[model samples]
Target: MSTEQIPEGVRLAPAMVAGARIYIPEPTWCDVDHASENASCVQDVDHRTAPAYLNRPGSDIESLLHVEGFAELSGAHADPVVMLNDATAMHPAQALRWAKDVVAFAEKVETIARSVMPELEA
Candidate 1:
């Protein structure tokens, strides 16, 4: 760890990367257990939220999502993104639009469900 003073409002933590100690900016949303010996914190790498599982009403199928935020350090992209499992990444605005569309689709599904099962109207 460097003796350099950490700036106010900024948090830096030391991590071992490739067998060398380095400092990395820690984000508030980062839930990584840095105390663990296996912790890996690399600069320019993304800090991500805990995986959230999304499941259908009555199915074994499910999906996972995570919101990842990156720092501008090392010339890496600083934009925050929503990642679907390991396949897709979307900008915050795109994620919001997609969420709105999902809401609308869910409403349509609810309407169809109610029509088919009038008991659901209760």
Candidate 2:
């Protein structure tokens, strides 16, 4: 075990989103498609709205850019409703695939910590 891995005393914590320490989730917004799906009385209505106003735009890590992430990775236009439905249906199988993903992600994190902040490896 690395000696530096042990904490010697109290230290200030990392910066966090404002008000997040209270444990309340931030107010969320949905695209028109999601909003209509939740707010509508019809269960089988097709969501055929323009893509411009349908989903939040940006990178996934920057925010929860649902269909945007898929579209970016896939280099194609996205259908927000169908993509979300697929995600929900596939979530269990998707989570099971983490058996391989977690090892790589954890190793990369530890490698960067040991390289950039050697004190953390002590």
- Prediction RMSDs, each to the true structure: 4.1, 19.5
- TM-score for all models, in order of appearance: 0.65, 0.28
For model 1, the stretches where C-alpha displacement exceeds 4 angstroms are: 1-10, 19-22, 37-45, 56-61, 64-78
Q: For residues 19-71, write the lDDT of model 2, one tens digit per residue.
A: 22211111122222332233222222222223212233564334332221122
Top candidate, metric lDDT: 1
- Tell how far residue 78 is off in model 1, in angstroms: 4.6
Q: Rate the local accuracy (lDDT) of all candidates.
A: 0.60, 0.33
Itemize residue pairs with steric clashes in candidate 2: 2-122, 3-122, 4-122, 5-122
Deviation (Å) of 102 in candidate 1: 1.1
Best by TM-score: 1
Question: Among all windows of ten consecutive residues in candidate 2, which has the lowest summed lDDT?
Answer: 21-30
TM-score, predicted candidate 2 vs. hidden true structure: 0.28
Q: Report backbone clashes per prediction.
A: 0, 4
Superposed on all Cα atoms, model 1 deviates from the true structure by an RMSD in Å of: 4.1
